[model samples]
Target: MLNLLSGLIGLVTLILMIPAVLPLLGALNWILVPIALFGAFIGLMSSKKSGQYFCLIVAGFGALRLFLGGGIV
Candidate 1:
């Protein structure tokens, strides 16, 4: 149950981050990348049992960004 909640939260966070941060990535000179990645890292680290789910959510967003050429749909 906790894992499920973490997964949902992680997924929501990843989705929310795209539109909110992508624009700033350029204006902020890429500084936000590390911050965002670090936040995701922290989220994963804090949830030992749901770490994989968080990582998967992060990776899935990365892959989507790579292939889709845009933010989450």
Candidate 2:
């Protein structure tokens, strides 16, 4: 249940992240980072770690993107 919800959130965040990868759209990652973190928190409630790791990785990527862009591109 919690894992499923977390996976869904990760999926949605990934979808949103796709567009945010573009040069000028990097600012979108600011919003995505928190969303992915929320997903990770939900995943933490589940018995399994897969969902939590997935969300964490997604959040990491988003944070990395933001860092590379110097917060905004």
Candidate 3:
């Protein structure tokens, strides 16, 4: 399902946010947060209840990271 895929992306993004993990993933840590946020946004915009619920959790974490980090600062 599209929702499921998006949620998975959120999970992976969380993993990638860690500096130690990002190198293992061979990705730039700076780029992953917004990708996760975009996935969460897509999930949130879905009409399905499951999508909304899962996305809320992922998005909450993503928002917290953004808040604590310099994403908005």
Candidate 4:
């Protein structure tokens, strides 16, 4: 159940990330990273590892984007 919810959250966050990747819109990652982390936390509560890993990857991507953008675009 928690894993399912986490996966869903990750999917939503991934979709949102598309727009955040735009040159001047990297600032959106500020909001996305936390949401991805929240999903990862939820996934951590599940018995399986897939959802947790997926969320973590999403969070990582968001963090990388932020870093590359110098925290903002």
Point to the candidate with the largest lDDT: 2
Model 1: per-residue lDDT, tens digit, 2-25? 455555555655655566445434
Off by over 4 Å in 4: none
Which scores better on TM-score, 2 or 4? 4
RMSD of each: 6.3, 0.6, 5.0, 0.5
Which RMSD does model 4 reach against the true structure? 0.5
- Among these predictions, the greatest TM-score belongs to 4
Residue range 1-73, candidate 3, lDDT tens digits: 7687777777776665565232233234446656766776777666654654554565566555555554532
Compose the digit string of candidate 2's lDDT tens values, residues 1-73: 9999999999899999999999999999999999999999999999987888999999999999999999998
Cα lDDT tens digits, model 4, 1-73, are 9999999999999999999999999999999999999999999999996888898999999999999999999
What are the models' TM-scores?
Answer: 0.37, 0.96, 0.50, 0.97
lDDT of 4 at 46: 95
The clash count for each model shown is: 0, 0, 0, 0
Clash count for candidate 2 is 0
For model 4 the local lDDT of residue 2 reads: 97
lDDT of 3 at 47: 60
Task: Assess each prediction's global lDDT (C-alpha) against the native.
Answer: 0.49, 0.95, 0.58, 0.94
Which residue pairs collide in model 4, if any? none
